[model samples]
Target: MDRLTLRLPPDLVRRFDAAAAGRGGRSRFLRRLMEEAAQAPLPAPVAATPAGRTGKLTLRLAEADLALLEAEAAVLGLSRTQWSVALIRRRLQRRPQLTPPEAVAFIEVQRELRRIGVNINQIARAMNTAVLEGTVLDLEVAQLAAFGDEIRAHLTGLRAAFEGNLAYWSDGT
Candidate 1:
């Protein structure tokens, strides 16, 4: 492959490096962007829309605030407007917007909780059958108690995680 070089302003390079960090660095990031751009269709010229179809919004933000917004949006691979709209929609809907990592953690926790619930259900069923048939219960009380404790711990952790997510979002970070 042929090599190409371009000179960029220092500040722009810094911003690009920051954005490209943890995303396979500058070269890979630029390559991916170029590939995406090559595959994307060109935008058509703007057309007039019905008056009631959409609304326009304008806001004046401080430089620091704009920088923060740009950084957050960059981290998520979103445009500033897209990120802002998503944040607004999530707030309006009373839903927490989780990052990819957060979503995966939540999914794993939920799966573990479901597995524990299934085990508890099995224990309960076995005990119920034993009681109905007037047979000795083979399960130990300590085992059931342990499961209960485990569930409580898991629930506590889940609650903490949810509260942390809420606080992080609400704090404008």
Candidate 2:
């Protein structure tokens, strides 16, 4: 479809938006209005549909707000009821909120991970310095370097466990 660019004063724009609202937004409303104008003079605004299955939810909002709602609903090929219901359901059914105990546990796990990270950084720095200085490695540092593969594997396992617990807690698993 071709786009039309027309400039209007702020007051006229506001009036145009108000007229288009609650009746399938600017494009559809304007189309209908133009057709009506060609045939005869314009009439009063269209009344809203009944609440139907859902209970009433009436609000007096700005014309632009109404137009935005109508446009969004139309984009999904949904009536206002379906669109609103879907939005409500999506917001209501997000991941479960953490309890106090769970929140504490989560923070503790994060702290432990940071502590482990700091230890790893210290080890790496000591190892790098020993290599650069051509100094003999300490017995403990030698053992740690020898068992690096096992240490890395254990850290990877810990990370997997953390992720699993996080998903379980967040998703109510």
Candidate 3:
């Protein structure tokens, strides 16, 4: 490959480094960006409507904020505009928005809770059958109690995760 050198401002370099972190470093990230840009079709210009809406808005962001936005959007596989619009809608609707990682965590927690529920249900059915047959199941009662404790702990952890997510959105962080 041919070598090319370009000089960039220190602040710009810092932002680039921050955005490139965990993305296979600067070179790979830059190359992927270049490839995407090359393949992406140019957006057509928007014409003004008679109602005077051009459907265009612009914002000036600080370098650090821009870097953070780009990093987050990249992680979610979304464009900055998409991310911003979702955030705005979420805020306006007073709804919580979870990142992909957060969503995955919640999904795993839900699966565990479901599994626990199934186990509890099976234990209850077995106990009911034993009772109907005039037999006592001491072991099953102990197991059911243990399962109840386990479910309580899981629910507590799940509640904490939800509260943390809510706090994050509440603070706009």
Candidate 4:
């Protein structure tokens, strides 16, 4: 038999097979499975952004630029299609009045802070769960201290970037 075998969760397969067993004809169940398997995933296309108060901004990236995004998306365990949707969302929400350099720095700093905040929340949850479970480690307290340090570091970096010639874009446009 030129059958291509695949491994699926036994429980799920059992459920399907059981349901299919009640069918009068052998082809009915196999046909349903083939139909489901042959169907392609629904396309998740990027949403078109509406113009905001800022002037029109259009961007076209080279294939290599897209490759970089696809690579990053793969690393983050997200589909490239979903990653593009997120990128478009960020772009549309950006304050376009800011100059090019300011826009870049501002977005970077905001992302850094957001990441740090999320990390802090995760750490806090872990710490709380550990405590509830009566698990103690000498380094647990020290690790908890790092959350404040991370916040301070991000804020300091943002301040430094602001103080440096980063006030305006150097593109000299």
| Best model per lDDT | 1
Q: Candidate 2 local accuracy as lDDT?
A: 0.65
**lDDT of candidate 1 over 1-173, digit per residue (tens):** 97888878999999999999979999999999999999999899898986779676767799999999999988876788877876776778767777667788899989998998899888888776765332334344556788899989989998998887676556465
Model 4 residue 28 lDDT score: 75
Better of 2 and 3 by lDDT: 3
Clashes of each: 0, 0, 0, 0
As a TM-score, model 2 comes out at 0.30
Least accurate stretch of 10 residues (summed lDDT) in model 4?
A: 164-173
For residues 1-173, write the lDDT of model 2, one tens digit per residue: 67777768999989888888888898899889777889986688888866664565656669998788788777656676665655555446653334345457667766766766677677778777666443445654665564565557657865676565345335243
lDDT of 3 by residue, 125-153 (tens): 87776663323576777788898898899
- Model 4: CA > 4 A from native: 1-98, 132-136, 164-173
| Error of model 3, residue 74, in angstroms | 6.5
Cα TM-score of candidate 4: 0.33
Higher lDDT: candidate 1 or 4?
A: 1
Candidate 2, residue 1: lDDT: 69
Candidate 4 displacement at residue 27 in angstroms = 93
Candidate topping TM-score = 3
Distance (Å) between predicted and true CA of 70, model 1? 2.8
lDDT of 4: 0.64
